[model samples]
Target: MFKILVIDRCYFTRTGMESWLNQTDLFPASFLVAALHNLMLAKEHIVQWQPDLVIADLHGFKNEIHHIQQLASLFSVCGDGIKVLLLESGEDAQLSDYFTQFNIEETLLKTASLDTLAQSIDAIVLSRPTRTEPKPAVPLLTRQEEKVLTLWMEGRSNQSIATKLSINGKTVYTYKRNIRMKLGMDNRFTPFLSLPDAIN
Candidate 1:
C-alpha cells in the first residue's frame, strides 16, 4: 500500500486535500502529517518519515530554499520512484528555476479545484513504477524511524514530528543525530543540500 506524508503548518487549510484523498478509491494506502513551524524542523522531519510520497504546501515559507532543497534530497534518496507534489499559489514561470534545481516532478497551484488535485494524486500514485529490486535496507532506520523520515521529507520540525508520533523532543533529536551519522551528514553545515549534490 502507498504511504503519504502531508506537510503544512495550518492543518485547516489542508482540509480539501485530506478530504479528497479520503474519498478516493485509487489509493490503497494511508497518509499522515508532519507539520512544522519553520524550515529547520521540516528538514529534521524528512529524516524521520521516509514516506512513499510527499505533499508540501509552499505558502508561508516560500523564501526558504533550504527546506525545498531538503525535500529534493529526500526525493533523491528515495530515487525517482517516489513522487513529490508541490502546492503553491505562485506564478509558474517564477518556479521553473527552483523546480529545476530540486528536480520537482509536479506542481499544483493552490487555486486548483479539489477535483484536479484528486486527479493529480491519482495519476501520480497510479503511474508510479515498480521497483526492480528490493530497496536496500537503510541501517539507520527502524520502522518507526522510517515513518519519521517520511514526515521529515514533508518538512516537519522535531517537536511537531514528535507530537505526531507521540514521542518526545529529545528522542526526536537522537533520531536526527543518528540519521545524520548514518547518512554521513554529520560534518556538513546544511547536510541535506550538500549531501545530495555531492553524491550526484
Candidate 2:
C-alpha cells in the first residue's frame, strides 16, 4: 500500500484530490490517504504518518517564502526518503527558484489539466524510492495533553486553558510543552494552523 498525504487549505481541493487519486485506474497499488487543510501542521503529520508521497498546494504559501523553506528542510532530512508534488498558482512562478534550490523537482501549476496532474503524480511515483522496512510508530499525545492542545488551538490563552481544564496554570503549560514535543515541534515560535480555524 502507498501512503499519501494531501495538504491543501481548500477543503474541496483536499478531498477532490484524494478522491480522484483513489478512484483512478492509473496505478494498481492501493493508497492509504490522509488529508489536512493546514500547512503548519504538515510537518507533524508527515513525520508521524511517514507517507510515501506528499501532494502539497503551495498557493497559500506564496507570500511566506520562509514557510516553504521550512517545509523543504523537513523533506531534506526525512529519515525514509519520500517524494513531493507541489501545486502552485500562476503567481508562484517566481518560487520555482526556491524549488530548484531545495532539490524539489516535481511541481505542477494549479490550473493544469487533470491529465497533466495525473502525469506528474505518475512520474513521482515511478521515481520514488522503495521502502525496505516499516518505520516505528511515533508516540501519541496523552488525553490531557490532547485536551490542552485542542483548547490552545482554539485561541485559548494558557491561563484560559488552565481555567477550562480546571488545572493549575503550570500544569497547562506542561501539557502544552509535552504536546509540542510529541508533535516534533520543539521550536516554541513555530507557527501552527489551528485545526478548527483552518478546516473551514
Candidate 3:
C-alpha cells in the first residue's frame, strides 16, 4: 500500500491532486491520499502516519526563504526519509536559495498538468530504490537538543518549549532542525516511536 500526504492551502489543489492520483492508470490498487491544508496539522500526521510521499504547494515560499527553508528542511526530515514534492509557480522558478539548500523530490511548475504530476508521482514511487543495509546509527544529541526533542515528542508546542527553557521559540525550531539532522533518519523513522531507545 502507498500512503501519500498532500499539503496545500487551496481546496481545489488538494482535491485535484487526490482526484488525479485516483484516476491515474499507472497507480495500482491499495493507495491512500491523506491531506491537510497547512503544515501544523500535517506535521503530526507525517510523524504518525508516515506517508510514502509528501506533496507541498510552495506558492509564496520565495518571499520568506529562511523561514520556508526551515519548514522545507524539517518537512523533508519528517517524511521519515522520503523527499517532499514541491509545487511552485513557474514564475517563482528563478534560481534561489531554497533550491540550493533543500532536497526536494521534484519541483513541479503550476503550469504542469495533473497528468504530468501523476507521471512524476508514478516515476518517483515506482522507481524508488530500496535500502540494503541499515544506515550508521545517528549520534547522540546535545543536552539542549535532547531536552527540546523530549518536550516536542511530549506534545508540547515550540512556544511551550521556549517558555519552559527560557529560550526563544525560533531557537527551539533551530534545535528541531538540528535534531532531525543528528538523527539522520530515513523513510523508516517513526518519530518518538522509540523514544526511550533514541534518547538513551
Ten contiguous residues minimizing lDDT sum, candidate 1: 191-200
Q: Each model's RMSD to truth, in Å?
A: 9.0, 5.6, 11.5
Candidate 2 displacement at residue 63 in angstroms: 5.1
Q: What is the lDDT for 54 in model 2?
A: 85
Candidates ranked by lDDT: 2, 3, 1
- The local distance difference test score of model 2 is 0.68
Per-residue lDDT of model 2, residues 1-200, tens digit only = 67778877677888888888887486655566777754545667776778888888766655544456665655664444677778865555556666666545477878999988877777776666555554543426656775776577666777777888899999987887777776667654555523333221
Identify the superior model by lDDT, candidate 2 or candidate 3.
2
| Per-residue C-alpha lDDT of model 1 across residues 98-195, encoded as one tens digit per residue | 56666566788778887787777767766764333433322344666666655665667777778889999899778767766655565456444232
Q: How does residue 200 of candidate 2 score in lDDT?
A: 16
- Lowest summed lDDT across 10 adjacent residues in model 2 is found at 191-200
Error of 2 at 24 (Å): 5.2
TM accuracy, model 2: 0.66
Q: What are the per-residue Cα lDDT tens digits for candidate 3 across 103-142? A: 6778877788877877788777665553433233222566
lDDT of 1 at 55: 78
TM-score of decoy 3: 0.55
lDDT of each: 0.59, 0.68, 0.64
Candidate 3 wrongly placed segments (more than 4 Å):
24-26, 60-66, 93-95, 129-200
Between candidates 2 and 3, name the one with more favorable TM-score: 2
Model 2 clash pairs? none
